[model samples]
Target: MIMVFGIGDYGLYEPHEGHFAMVGQEMIFQGNWITPHLNGSPYLNKPPLLYWLIAFSTKVFGAHEFAARLPIGLAGWLGILIAWKWTRQLWGVSASRIAALMLSVTVGWFLFTHQILIDVLLSTLLLASNYFLWRVIYQPQSWVYWWAAYISLGLCLLTKGLIGIVFPLLGFLVLGLVRQDRKLIRRLRLFRGSLLVLALILPWFIAVEQANPGFWHYFVVNEHLDRLLDRRFPPDYEVSQISAFGYLIITALWCFPGILFLPSVLKFTWQEWRQGFRDRASTLERQYSDGILLLAIAAILPVIFFLPFSSRLIYYGIPAIPPYVILFGGWYSRYQTSVSEEQSDQPLAISIKQSYLPANFREKKRNKVVTIYSAIAICLGICFVSTLFFHSLIVQSLPPVINNSDTKLLMFIVPITLGLGWIISGIGIVRQSRFALLPVFLALIVTYISVVQGFIAYQDVRSSKTLIRAADSCLNIDTLWIFEGSREIGTAGAISYYLNQGQNYNAKDIAEHHDTGWEKGNSGRIYRHVMVLSDGGKNRIPPNFPGSPPAYLIDRQQLQSYWNSDRPVVFITDFLRQFNDLDDPENRNLPQGVGKPSLIINNRKLYLNAAAQKFECNF
Candidate 1:
């Protein structure tokens, strides 16, 4: 419910959200559920599961932002539940509850919950698979858990790709090597499990490959391998690649507040490591050590896996968040228990503490606890002060980040609130208060809600919905609209979605067909596809954007032809600078007869061909 709160308050963001929202909407409009379509083109970048969920959601809830995001929100909700249940099973109820609370307020998890992307759903599915696999390891006699693990893994495969299986496999491999546990390996039944996974995922792969030849190579080698090696053709994520240090910083931020307890979590892991190596260890002791070790590995593996890759996104560490919270939950639960014991009147509690921990060790433990919270408080304090004093400096430095001081301040509110929360929580922790973490969690929830509300401030800058709506009055069934740009689909997706949906343009008409040449078994002719207008004569689809397919790229000759054609053509471009050139009477860059824009809003403009003047309407 928290994740879903006010989800529809803002318009869908450009590019990412607009892309997915429209693809799912197009699935319903086109009556094609197996293949995902954007604008008029098949979007082969991702699998259809996310689109399927979005289509089903919009079907029941109507075509709107809430419905588009509802699926991911619910997925996030389920992820929280999984964290709670898994933690309870491994640790206890208190830890389980804390884990859920931690995950709900996690910066990356919460932000992605409201997004229209596949990562939240994919991460949730991956978590489910991980939990069920862990269950298989602990309860080897339970075939149900085994089957559930495979099924979830298969769904993960459908959700993203090989990483669905790769992450879990990698984590378990590291766990097995660390423990030298061949028993877990033998219990896996790799042959049968592999067959089950193949059965579940193969049919879709086969069908998609048959539908589009070379899809296997494209998806497997090009998309996966080339992407890993940073050699993807028609490169899409050149701006996304980050250094190793950048990855650490991003991961730390994603796991904020939760990361405040990192030193203790590491300390606990180290203690467990030493315990596991001890000459004398009980079954329960080994079990606890192994569980902590597994959780630690699960939490860090994704970060490690993506560290070497040049292409990375801030949200790529989402799958790691669940285990991270679980680790925090276990450590925090122990800390809370110890505090309670210290305050209790029971002689048994006093004896246990004195025997297990000497006075110096107890003092050191208390100091460590104080140090963690104090460090976080100090850091947050510094951030709050820096942001308050250097507000103008920040706004000037990142001029393109937020359009105005208000939105920049709004963005700053999150960190400010987080800083204050840490300060209060630090006091509570120093006093050994039972609810020390509550204030920070509450602040996270409240500030995130505010962040959602404040997000609308960027609607004009990030979304083209309003601009597209202004042009709606001029549009009709016969109006031809082409987004003119050479860059990746920016607001073009939002424009395409709004234009097609507002005017009741049929899916076929919106996705006006051009020869893709793939159908004639002419592999050579396949180069003449969607995006790029060939340098001289050929056509090529830039791999960067599969979001808005109905949008056609316009070259000089095509622009001149459209301008001179008797039929109505609405030339739309979001690049305001281009509109300036088009408006200049002396600017020969545009066709000779081009005049002022018929409609202009924000950074987008619409020019009416001579034939479109008859259909002109004001905003």
Candidate 2:
């Protein structure tokens, strides 16, 4: 219930969910599934895979917010399952359980799970591919595992482009090289695997390209290459960059309680190296080496791949979390190893036995410390979950008029949750739970939090119906046109999606499509009846514009000339307060000879052209 109930609503009000809904609606309306076109031309900002998934989902569930976000929630849930299975395969059931619990409660996973984005889907598929890849490496005879890996990789490609494949492929290759797993490499079937990957991905690429001319260049080259190399795209288009070392620190902080075991993990690993890799040695030693290596690789590889490019974002590190959690689980598993009493003649054997055994009283005390740390981690997880639930409840209870207060209050929840988690962790240092109680308690907390957060998200989505309705009213206008002056594509996309119901309208920018006869023979007759939606400020009209202004301008002089008389023109803007000072006649310095707006609407001010009243309404 938590996963699906509130999944659609949490952040649906803003640019994210609204924009996605627009794209999904367009796909349905146009009846063109292959090429996702926005405002009429080919939209190459992202891969078509996510849109295709949402379209298919909307067809099944209906075009509602919950329906749109269903796939992402499902992917997040599935990621937990895959994390469990993969970790269990590496370190046994106990570790798998711990890893799964860790992932279930992590802040990043919790927040994004309810969002209508492609990152979770990409992460889930990547995990699946990694799981299968691990199986192939461990059991080379399993051709099915190899096939599964490639298939998952292909799906991941569809989800988020090349980085999906690049991160995992590089990690796997580098790890294999480090471990000198020659047999695994020697039995490689690259031909068959490549074929499977191609078969899965090529069909969509070929079909979409054939359907939308220039689709390949814009999506693959311009979006993927040009954006990365030149940063010529819009400011919001790229991810922020962090130094490789800073990434490690942020990742460690993000991982929190799980990261607390790093020292022990390292100590355990060193013991293993001294012992010579042997099965009979301490399990703790073996686990520490394995966990650290895997976690380090997972945590570091994605950052390395994205660091070179100027773009970086918090979610870019998402793929790293699962492996890091698995490492945490492995470290937790080592606590079960029993100390050996017998002294060994062999130096390797002695090191292994000593590291594995809690031989001395001091070592036994150390074991207690480790147990307390695990307890702390569990407490932190619970606190994080509780805070999110509280914030959701508060937000849901408040009225729309209190939106600013609600937003401010909502921001406090995460930090408080983190602070509380730290306090609980501190408490765990002094108290040791009875054997088995901590794990069970932690499990309950994780499950409760996941379900609760999911529910809140559902309610959020339901509340967003009003915003959608508002956008819908604008769509009802027969002569609707969007101005590029102050309107953002993000907002425009959301409005367009809701209004157009996902149909491809070939909607054009007011300036760019001005000459296409939209305003030609119609003149003021066309302009009089048409309802223009604009940001109503300094119209920074692009140079070498293709079309005339759509009956609106930031300049009073342009308005007077266009209107043919100083009747008054209506100006629409969300930021009406910004124009307050400009409205003052004393402060208004006319540019050589220019006039100011004559009237203002709620956010929109009307400065009517006296001659405009004489023109016939075309509609």
Which ten-residue region of model 2 has the weakest summed lDDT?
520-529
lDDT (C-alpha) at residue 508 in model 1 = 49
The C-alpha stretches of model 1 lying farther than 4 A from their native spots are: 273-283, 339-366, 389-416, 486-491, 502-541, 544-555, 574-592
Q: What TM-score does prediction 1 earn?
A: 0.84
lDDT of 1 by residue, 1-619 (tens): 7889878887888668888887787777767676666656666878778888888998898878889899999999999998898777655667778899999999888888887777788888888877887777767789999999899889899889998888878877877898798997777777788999999989888887777667887888877898888787756454446788888898888888688779877876566444544556544445555666667777888798888877776678877788888878867766665534434333211222121221222345467656667677766756764666776666676435355767676657866777777777777777766687887888788788777866666566667777767765655545556555423443455566665553333234434443321111112211111222222121122444323334345456876776687766666653423333433322323454768987765665667788778765766
lDDT on C-alpha atoms for all candidate structures: 0.69, 0.53
Top TM-score prediction, candidate number? 1
Give the lDDT of residue 443 in candidate 2.
Answer: 45
lDDT of 2: 0.53
TM-score of 2: 0.68
CA-only RMSD, every prediction? 6.2, 9.2
User: Which stretches of candidate 2 lie above 4 Å from their native place?
Assistant: 10-13, 238-257, 260-295, 336-363, 366-429, 434-468, 471-488, 500-619
After TM-score superposition, the amount by which residue 613's alpha carbon in candidate 1 deviates from its true location, in angstroms, is 3.3
